[model samples]
Target: MDFHYHSLPDLFEQLGLPAEMPAVEHFIERHHPLPAAMLLADASFWSPSQASFLREEVLGDADWAEVVDDLNSRLHH
Candidate 1:
């Protein structure tokens, strides 16, 4: 069997995540490409905010944690 991989940006596009954050673009440029095809294939779900946290925090600095936390709180509550 053969498998193909897609980057996080491509996966986000496919999954319909908002693509507005430039910081996220810069982040994706530096890190390893995500296993997007696999992530998408999984039936699990993510709230938009959760996905945003993964994108921003996973690739970004610790300072971004504050922003993500604030946003997460707003989203959940």
Candidate 2:
């Protein structure tokens, strides 16, 4: 799917993580306000390649920047 528009679950699924609504909700509630880059770099569930692709490809690309920003906002207080 193009990263132009995505729901939180879609975004998480694309990132190779669990995208179940409750799981995502709990994760966010448990760890809201996560710094995008730091979380991506440090989260053990994500492989190095996955994190790099997300940080350098999705986040770095202008086309997907909006999606990344939205995720960041939801993550932060």
Candidate 3:
């Protein structure tokens, strides 16, 4: 399979969110510091579809995994 590099903005766009850097940063700032015990895919701010995409991509280690993981880290900080 061919591999494609996905950035944070790409992930956001795939999730149907605002994909601009400023919007992404604002989103992180608004929802950040996620509880240590909370799963990123279980975060309340995500729609069910968005959450499912995150969960599946990470679990499957798909093309979106790295960028999804990056987003997970940012949200927890």
Candidate 4:
């Protein structure tokens, strides 16, 4: 089996968002500093489908989990 290493841009594409680095950076900048008590998947900016994808990937410890965790950290700071 081929293992594909995913990146933040890939995650954005998978979520049907802009995948360019600038767009990704802009997105993070727009949504920076998520509330400490808020879960990444529970943030108001995400669509239901996007939120579900994040929750499932993290809860299942799937391939997307690492990147999702990375996003979570970025959002928190």
Candidate 5:
């Protein structure tokens, strides 16, 4: 699959996150992937459910892997 956007905010929106630039930026800045990976699906934030969906439905399977990997790369970087 060909994923379009790569920025955290865009990926967030694609993944059904809030997608607000400022908020997304702040979130990425505050939560690094090292921790976000563990906290994403369980965090007390909007990502808990959303992240679970992405991890289980998207990345967990072969479908949407491109976007999921892209988002992961962007989030980690």
Candidate 6:
């Protein structure tokens, strides 16, 4: 079966991404759902460093701290 990323980034422009960076084609020859969601659902192409840059740019370090806390809280639950 063929599949493609169908995430918010692909649907909205407010995310500021190129609108075509993320796709299932990179992972599977025939296309498929992302192997994992959390790692692939959001803009799908973000690197760790790039994520940190975006966080710092959009949320600042203090806000990024809260974001981390929130993510940790959700993960632990």
Better by lDDT, candidate 4 or 1: 4
Per-candidate clash tally: 0, 1, 0, 0, 0, 0
Per-candidate Cα lDDT values, in order, are 0.44, 0.66, 0.92, 0.94, 0.59, 0.38
List model 3 lDDT by residue over 8-51, tens digit each: 88988999999999999999999999998899999999999999
Per-residue error (Å), model 3, residue 36: 0.8
Backbone clash tally (model 6): 0
> Poorest 10 consecutive residues of model 3 by lDDT?
1-10
**Sequence-dependent TM-score of model 6:** 0.25
After superposition, which runs of candidate 3 have C-alpha atoms over 4 Å from their true positions?
none
**TM-score to native of every candidate shown:** 0.27, 0.61, 0.96, 0.94, 0.46, 0.25
- State candidate 2's TM-score: 0.61
The 10-residue segment with the lowest total lDDT in model 1: 34-43
lDDT of 1 at 5: 48
**lDDT, ranked from best to worst:** 4, 3, 2, 5, 1, 6
* Model 4 agreement with the true structure over 30-69: per-residue lDDT tens digits: 9989999999999999999999999998998888988999
| lDDT by residue (tens digit), candidate 5, 4-45 | 435556557766767888877677677556454553344445
User: Top lDDT: which candidate number?
Assistant: 4
Off by over 4 Å in 4: 1-3
Residue 39 lDDT in candidate 1: 34
TM-score of candidate 5 against the unseen true structure: 0.46
Question: Which residue pairs overlap in candidate 1's backbone?
Answer: none
Top TM-score: which candidate number? 3
Residue-level lDDT of model 1, residues 1-77, one tens digit each, is 33344444444454465455564455435332434343311213566655665566535644344444333333333
RMSD of each: 14.3, 3.6, 0.7, 1.5, 4.2, 12.1
> Could you tell which candidate, 5 or 6, scores higher by TM-score?
5
